[model samples]
Target: MLAELKELFATWIAAVAAAVEAVMDRLASRRRVVLQEIDGDSFTARLGSVAKGAGLRPVSFRLTPHGRPEPPLSPQWRAALRSSVVEVQMRPDQVLFREVDFPKQAADFLDGMVRAQIDRLTPWAAGEAVYGLSPPQPGPHDRIVLMLAATARAKIQPLVDLAAGLGAASISGVVTVPADETAGTTIRLFNTRLAQAGRLAISIPRLLRGLLIGGGVAAAASFAVSAYLGARLDTELQDVQQRLNQRRAALRLNQGTSSAELLLTQRKRSSASSVMVLEALSRALPDSTYTTELRIEGDKMQVVGLTQDAPSLIRLLEQSPQFTRATFFAPTTRAAEDPGERFHIEAHITPYFGSGS
Candidate 1:
């Protein structure tokens, strides 16, 4: 059981190593090509370029089997052919011919050529016409060596349409190089190995131009929005602050007015209290005793007098309703000639009454 597990582990390791090596080889290899091919019934219309060390070798070829007859060429076929670079490579049992042809000015002849190429390529190149062209370079004419992958018209056309829709100035040529360095390049290799053989280098100039235009518009919009919002916020903040200041100032003025009113009300109350105290004293004094001096100090009243009779005055004060618990100062008798005695007295007067209390 341990040996079996070891063998399985070894196999997995070998597979992993092989995959890593394959990826490294692809990255390091310099072999590449670009091709555009439209196959015919008896011949294939191909447009391609071989990438040399630095330059390009333009090539076009039509591969045909022996004993097979050549198809007639038409105007549309000629138009397609006008843009080709051809080369012939003969096989042991097959004849390979490559040529550029121009259809006669007549419409019928052009139509015939188009039909002929279409019929010939039907078995090998089915469905819609396939276009695969390569990036241009100079290289060997013996046979176009290819990377292992090929280009697909279905894939390449959308890219072409995309470039056209965006109003691209030009579309880069398609590549049909083989991923295998040893196998000679062919239509089949271009179909199968283009993803490996091809390099997709975008147009730096076009991209930069788009970015500059788009970026400027975006930046301007952002700045305008920021400035507008900032100004609006500033204005709102100022309005709120102004309102707060006004409210604060108004509050201070109101408080000062309220304080003055309170002071005036207190003074009026004190004056009324004085007037009432004097009135009460006048009403309560006895007939035998007339106050000679009346002094008011805060809430206390003092009375000094010379009465016709001191006993009568004392009795009158004690009986009065206004004075509470009166005390008489020491009385001073007059000289033998004088008529009456003098006395000083002090009394506390109630300032105001609440509920008869």
Candidate 2:
């Protein structure tokens, strides 16, 4: 049993090492083509190394924009470009460069800090742009300054798709500074890898559309279920309202003498109901203010309250459509015994149901 277990472990170890070797080989052996965009749409293609800083070969092959067959590709050139990593270099004019200074503590979170400010720094949101940053260097006042390079994704996506159509293994997008700079600065904006660039671009949109369609279906189903359950409750409420209207109609028919009834109706119209006055006060008072006592008589309402700012309550009540002519009935006072000032406020209650009197 021990010998069998040992053999199994050896097999697993071998498999793991083989996987690592495969990944390293893929990284080391991948050939790169740097497409130097010229004349706004055309590119000068040159072969480059996967090794860092080896740079592109000096020999140049100019390729025209799509939809033109000015120079046909030889089978050898087609084979060379097939399944190679393509690097699309944007001209300095195509990119927007901005210098930003951040506190030294933000070094580790530079990506997030820059992303949050992308909208402020450029015309596009973070998600809508392909962007990169220079290495942070010492700046004034214990800060670090980093150069941000960005361009609209829409502007470069067509170029990416063009490379992918040529059977690229992966695609990398970059932008460089003008030759006048002391040192050439190249910032990589985006990368799509794993010899799947072509299929990936098509699949991403399909995936996003599928997710949206599924979410909409789920929301509709939930709404239907809730509406089904609430139908009976809505019917019951309608029935209750109908019975109330019938009862009021019968009471009006039974009331004696039209003149006497008209007098009572006039009094009712002028009266300030406690419920309405309380609701009005509740709506008028600030969240920090609370009343200890409330009184409603005829068209007047008086509220005795404790508040952080007692004087502001008068203006608040006066501004409300439910009350008018609001003022202080008594002095607002502060005492050591209480946490807030005690206030006596009076406002005339408007009898208009939905309209200000």
Candidate 3:
């Protein structure tokens, strides 16, 4: 149960972070690097310039067979890689591509569906391969066409691992497939950036959409809690009012009985209300204090409660206009199971006829 609670807390934190990811993007490093994976071995790279998403002229690097680039890089390039967004585009021949059609309604579940049948569709099992799907395209008979690209993890792990080892700020694996009649100009097949700093990550537009969705969900929850509390408070107020009405009716019945009855009625009208006493206590007590039991006898009241500082409660109750002569009635004690000190306090409840109601 504790493990589940911790996991739930972590998930909530992650969701909150994701909701505010857009604000974080404003402080992110924009330096970019595009590494073109060549011959399943080496790469030709381009560094980002003043222009957004554009890179400098591509430079060929002598690289090992699907391993590290040869001749350690200069400090300048290494430093750039530390904060640069690195995108590795694999050669078309490196990835296996296929087209699959499904009911358009299944578009949202395409990732799970493709992954489930990956072994049958590709040469490798799901776990053995890195896979991705292109944006769905509308097809005949209420269907959608999806392009699937998959490759052995062994083929891509080296490049991703190398980028991370070099301390690339962010890494991505991308592949280009031969576009068909159904496919427009763009078809993004795969992206795997589990490098030192994780992937290039979710896009800004998606992040903003998530923020809006989270806001909507939070607003709905607040409304629900507010409505529930409002209903409960109204019910409590009505019950208190009903009790006051019953007391007033009983007093009126004995109004002209005798001199004793007249004095009793006057005393009853001038006495502090139990509801008012409770309200005053609730407002005066610190949030850390919780009352487990309460007793009212004549003009005095005794309350048993748990608090972080039992002695401080006396001063608080005494300061309130509704209570006075606050003192501990029983010794404060702490039990092994109790979270805080438990104390019994007695206070004089002052009567005031400030309002007839």
Candidate 4:
């Protein structure tokens, strides 16, 4: 189960990484403008120019506070803003900046932690504030320092609305710098548009589309591998089954040209043979003795016949190798139709007569 979770996490990471890389590549090739609002009636505009080592050098131009170009350069500047990504910088007085200290452990969740404390950090309530945080820096002890910038939504909404009305593609971010501080200490108030309901609406879909295409490709590859393994397993099973069938056929062929019935008959003949027993009896008894009835049951034999001397017949039968325990079962008596005496004898038949005789 842990293995499956790790695999799922890896897939998501790959998808997100791919999406970010695509967006970054697109942005790297494009130019952008920075608009710094000085007052209600005027602002400074800087067009970004690519420098050595993929850096940007801004070319500054002043614009009217209405987001239109000023003086002789108005038309050219207006056209540039429409085609480039716009970042607006507001005056520090229009936004609020506060330094808040938090435990170093809260670094991972600084955004949520700071937002939750916004009401206490500033006079504005959470709903009335548009806020953002600077990257956390080391504090005095085991704590981290963050600069939280916030402003009433009413104060910043009008400027965003004006930029949208001027046909800007999208407002990227809003930052502010105190007149008494250096440019490095600029505080970001709002990184997303307040006038638009969903920030990154267009970019979100583009990233999602890239992720979907990558996921589809991964799914297709997995299916192809599964199908290939399944087919290979099936083929191996068939080959094994065919080999077993061939071995069975070879065994049947080697057993001679007989069906199941013929094999059974041969086995029965080898176990017991009545003809061999009869031949052994004929050799053991004299021609002078005549038999009227004879019966063989398993290894025992019974005889009812006429003999010149019935008592002597027992001795003769017992002396034979094929018979044992010869004795008279009934009394010998002379009969009118009989030439001599009528007698009954019984004996055990040896198994040697069945197979060897």
User: Using TM-score as the measure, which candidate wins?
Assistant: 3
Model 3 ranges off by over 4 Å: 1-23, 50-57, 62-67, 179-186, 189-357
Better of 1 and 4 by TM-score: 4
What is the Cα-based lDDT of residue 264 in candidate 3? Answer: 81
Q: TM-score: which is higher, 2 or 3? A: 3
- Candidate 4: tens digits of C-alpha lDDT, residues 1-357: 999987776666656654664575376544466767677445666765544113333334444345334443455555655535567777677677787889999999887787788899988888888887778888888999877778887665555664565555555546654545434566556644322223354455556667877999999999999999999999999999999999999988866666677778766654435676677778888888888988888778888888788888888888888889998888899978889899999998776653334
Write the residue-wise lDDT of candidate 3 on 117-136 in tens digits: 99999999988988778788
What residue runs in model 2 are displaced by over 4 Å at the alpha carbon?
1-28, 49-72, 179-182, 194-357
Q: In order, what is each prediction's RMSD in angstroms? A: 24.0, 29.1, 28.4, 14.7
TM-score per prediction, in order, is 0.24, 0.44, 0.49, 0.46
- Against the true structure, candidate 4 has what lDDT? 0.69
Question: For model 3, how big is the CA root-mean-square deviation?
Answer: 28.4
Give the local distance difference test score of model 3: 0.76
| C-alpha lDDT of all candidate models, in order | 0.45, 0.75, 0.76, 0.69
Please tell me which model should have the higher TM-score, number 1 or number 2.
Answer: 2
Q: Comparing 1 and 3 by lDDT, which wins?
A: 3
Clashing pairs for predicted structure model 2, backbone only: none
